[model samples]
Target: MDALLSLSNDLAAAVERVRGAVVAVNARPRLPSTGVHWRPGIIVTADHTVRSDEDITIIAPDGRTVAASLVARDPGTDLAVLRVHDTDLPLADLGDPGSLKVGHIVLAVGHGPRVSWGVVSALGGRWRTWRGGEIDQLMRLDLTLYPGFSGGPLVDVKGRVVGINTSGLSRQLELAIPVSTVTRVADELIDKGHVSRGFLGVGLQPARLPEAFRRRLTGASEIGLLVVNVQPDGPAAKAGVLLGDVLVALDGAPVGATEDVQAVVGARRAGSTVTATILRAGAPAEVSMTVGERPSRRR
Candidate 1:
C-alpha cells in the first residue's frame, strides 16, 4: 500500500506542475469553462472552442476567475488568442513542433472528467475541417478529450508544453496543432489584430518530369508545380501566370516543392513585388508579380 501511495503521489506532482498553465474558458452559453489559459500573458486556445461565444471568463487553478476577450484566431490552424486583465501568471515552456517525432512520450494536460494521461500516437497526420479547409502540422495523441479540454496543453515529460490540445480525431487519435504555430500567429494577432498572409491565388500540384522529359532537360528529377487554377483577379492572374504553367523557381531560387512556393509567397507582404520563374513548354521564363493580402477571417 505504501508503494502504491508513493506512485500516486509522484503522478499527482507531475500534473500539478502543469496545472497552473491550464485554464478554464467560460463564455456563458458555450460551456461553463472551456479550458483556456494565459501563457503568462498570451492567451491561447482552439479556434472552434470559442467561435460561437462571447465575453469569455477565465478561471485559474486556485478558483480565481477573470474576464477575457477574444483577440484573434484562425480556423485553418485551429488556433485563437485571448486577452485577460494584466496579471503575472505562470507560463508554459513552448517547444518546437517541427522537432517532434513519432513514439515520443508526451503528456496531454486537460480538465478531463478529471485530468488524464496519454502519449503521442502518431505524427504528420493531415486533417480537414467541416469547412473544407486543410490543417497543417497536426500532432496525434492517444488521449480522450471533450469540450473542456479543447484548448488545454500537451506537455512533455519535463512539463514543457509542446502543443495545444486542439481536437480529437477518433477514440484513440487526438490531435494538437503545434504550439509553435500558435505562438507565431499569436504575435501577429496581438500586434496587428489579424494574421497578414500573402496570397498568390493559384492552385498548384506537384508533378514529376517524365524520364523522357528529364533526359531532354538538364535539371534534376523534372519535379515542378503545375498550376491547376489561377484566381480570376488574383496576383497570379494580374502577373500573367496562367493555367498549365510549370513553376520552377521563386526570386531566383529553385522551387522544388509546393511548400517552397507557399513559404516564399506566404512570407511576402501585400503590395510587395516578387519574381517567379516558370518553365513554359520547353523555355525558361520569369514573371514579376505583386503579392496581395489574404482576406481576414474575423467578422
Candidate 2:
C-alpha cells in the first residue's frame, strides 16, 4: 500500500540522515562496539566496551581510522568518553527522549549500515543501574541490539537521536541511556576526570522503628537505618556521628534502607552539606554532615 511504501522510504531516509556520526569503537579485543560523535572531538560509547585504554581506535563513517584517547569513564552509568582529533565527524542531531511513548517506532543505528528497528516497549521512573548508577529515567526497547551496537544511537523515524543504545546497562533487556542523562554524564566527564558520587563514610543496617515513634514520624519510613560503623576521621565521624545512632532521615527525607540513602546522596556532589536526623540513645537529634566524594573504586 501507499502508506507502507511511505513508511519504508522514511526509514531509509532516517538512516541516511544520522549515519555520519556513527563510528565503530575498537577499544576491546575481538568484539568491537559502536560510538557516537556526540560533540566536536568528543566520542561517547559504552564504558564496558573500552577494555584497553592505550591502543583505542575509531573507524569513522568515511572509512577513516582515527586514534582516540580516553577522556574519562563512569562504569556506574556504563558510559565512557573518548577524544579524537583530526576528524570532522558530525555531531548527532539529538531529540528529547522524554517525548517517547510505548509502541512508538524507533530505530537503533550503529556504525555504517548496522541497524535494527523496534518499538518503545515500556517506560519507568528513575532507576538505579546494577553498577549503582542513578538513571534519570528508565527506557526499555523491544529492539535487537546486534553485536557491536552497544554504544550506537536509538533514533526516531525522522532520525533525531533519542538515546544511546547499550546492553551493558541491563542483562536481560535492551536499554538506552536517555539523551538527558548522556549529556549530563558527558559534561561531567569533560569538566572533571570522574563522576562524583556523594558519600558519608558510615556502615548501616536497616532496623524497624517502634510503633510509637513510627506514628510520630508520619509521612516517613517506619524503618530506619542503624549505624553499625562510622569511619574514624570520615564525614560521619567528623560530624560527631556515633555507631549507636539510628539514622532516621536525611535532608528531611526518611530513609528506610541503604538504597534510600544512596538515592539521596548519589544525586548530590561532594562538599554539599546535608542534615541527618538520628536517634541517639532513644532521643531524636540532628547533625549537619558535609558530604564527601566516594572513592571511584574500592581498594
- Per-residue CA lDDT of model 2 for 60-88, tens digit only, reads 99898999999999898999999999878
Candidate 2 regions with alpha-carbon error over 4 angstroms:
210-216, 219-222
TM-score per prediction, in order, is 0.70, 0.94
lDDT of 1 by residue, 52-116 (tens): 54667787767787788887776656677888877455776666666777777676766532466
What is the total number of backbone clashes in candidate 1? 3
* Best-performing candidate as measured by TM-score: 2
Worst 10 residues of 2 by lDDT: 211-220
